[model samples]
Target chain A: MLNIIWPVFIIISFMYAIVTGRVNEVNNGIFEAVSDAVELSITFLGTICLWNGIMEIVKKTTLIQKLTKLLNPLVKVLFPDLKHSQKAKEEISMNMVANLLGLGNAATPLGLKAMKTMQEENCKKDTLSNAMAMFIVLNTASLQLIPTNVIAIRTSLNSANPTQIILPVWGATIIAAVVGVLATKLITKKIK
Target chain B: MVNYISAAAIPFIILGIIIYGLIEKNKVYDSFLEGAKEGIEIVFKMFPTLVGIFLAVGALRSSGVIELIVKIVEPMTKMLSIPSEIMPLALLRPISGSASMAVAVDIMKNYGVDTFVGLITSTIMGSTETTFYTIAIYTSAVGIKKTRGILVAALLADFAGMIASVIIWRIMSTSFC
Candidate 1:
């Protein structure tokens, strides 16, 4: 998907910039984006390490088993094909927990770990597996109880009630997750 | 009250995990160090992909292309009662996290955060993920080249979330007023 999307973005941007004589802005945009990426990575490094370190402890202890047990039923329902790969299932459960808590930073590392584990079970190395496709959709259609970032942004702007949108957000989030999962299941089934 | 709990949640989780490690007689410090090291490796692996995505998104935003597209789509969205002010955010929400965030902030600033437009923008931001960024990082980490049906499904989900946000806010704003 990114294969086509990435080039199309670049082509459109350049074409529009040239026609509008905004070539200099495009140059600055590229450079600014590179620096922003680096800055984001640097900021991400700390939280990633903190959570991954914490998760490592979770893994060594029986905490993973307990946590996995809590989420096992949901995991089984979502990715039944993953039953044979307990490791993948455990990682996915952890990722789901992080996401549910609205911990975006923590979720990414756990999610990447899950993806890596699922990749091991892929028969065709380069192609995305059914489980992998479902997992991506789940992450993209994130379902969280509270939207910390949006709330924080609102508070910073001195809103009368920062978290007023939380109820509406929950409604939208659940709808997104349901649609995303159903779409993935239906499409992948058709392909097979 | 909500803010306090959200802030305390992480610390409590960390403390719980460590205590569990101690009770289980696990090497908590060593394990954390090992995991932290792996975390660094993961970030390094993701940097190249991040750069590519950021570059494309940056160019798209800076070129005024998104704004142009939003203008073009404004009529169709209006027919559905979707505010044209949020069209840029609805479009960018799936593409880039920071870009959508900036747009959301812009909306909040232009229209008071307590207004209908601001409420809808906040809801959309909360519900939808940065689909392109999430997909690129997850797929590239495991070296999966063919993304197949993931993009379509993810984007469809994002669209649903955005529309849902608009509808819910419209209903709320009307009833409350």
Candidate 2:
């Protein structure tokens, strides 16, 4: 995955550059141009570690168990196969929570972990099962309540009312998120 | 690295491990070590994706392409009744924070940071993502096969937020700040 990530990034970047006439800059300072690859792990380490701890606590306390119990019936409609696993249910909810806070930085690994975890039981080996499709849909159409990271960036840059866009952002996230899950559920069901 | 974030997490983690060990009849420390080992692998996998996306954003700013986009978008920006002065930040706000920060600083240097333009640009900043960077990294990490609907919806969301920031600031300034 790491190997694939960079190659894909390079190709996308190269295409963007060529289209935007940034190819000239790349040729001139190839090293300088590629400077962003420098801190591949250090900064995200802090957030990842922090969120991982949060996730661990959430799982340990059975907040996840309770949460799964609550979301399960609704989830049964969207992800009928995942109707029962405490672990899978916890992972999905946490991943969704991270997205709600606009923690893309954190939500990502959790989402990936959930994907791998779901694959572990090997029950969905035959096809793109409801649970698998539901996860993909949820991750893509995550509902954000706070837009925390974006708000932080705005405030740091001196915006007068960083919270100004809160409502619209929330509205969009909710709509997309609900639509995303339901649409995927329906689409997958029809295909099956 | 794990020590700090795990500090508050220690109590829960220790409890979880102990419970697991007792249930499964294994050593608590052994279970914990296994968890830590798995955590490290997860972080390592995220590397090149984050690095490449951030770098590409840096390049966009340095190359002045972002500024050009801002200029092109300025008229539609004004039509929305948003201050045209914020056009740069409106465009940059979604792509990169540091770059947008510098641009905001430049706007502040010219407009005195407390003015409507500065305030609104900053507000817009607080409200958006580094769009391309997020799309690149997140979609890659999650692997979305089809992005058309997501792309259109996200951009519309961004546009809605951008407009909302301006209107809110305008109303807020006249009434509150």
Best by TM-score: 1
Against the true structure, candidate 2 reaches a TM-score of 0.46
Regions of model 2 farther than 4 Å from truth: A1-89, A100-104, A115-192, B1-75, B93-98, B101-114, B142-145
User: What residue pairs are clashing in model 1?
Assistant: none
* Cα misplacement distance, residue A157 of candidate 2 (Å): 6.9
Q: What DockQ would you assign to candidate 1?
A: 0.47
Residue B144 error, candidate 1, Å? 0.9
Residue-wise C-alpha lDDT for candidate 1, range B1-177, written one tens digit per residue: 444554465567679879988998888899999988987886676677667877886798789897787788888988988888788678767876765675576567667888989989999999999999999999999998988777999999999998899999888777777
Clashing pairs in 2: A154-B125, A154-B126, A159-B122, A159-B123, B94-B130, B94-B131
Which window of ten consecutive residues has the lowest lDDT sum in model 2 chain B?
Answer: B1-10
Residue-level lDDT of model 2, residues A1-192, one tens digit each, is: 325633554566566678877887755434553443343244434444443433443333433334445655555565567755768767777776666544455577877777666766635344444576666555544365544434433344455544454553554445545555556655665665
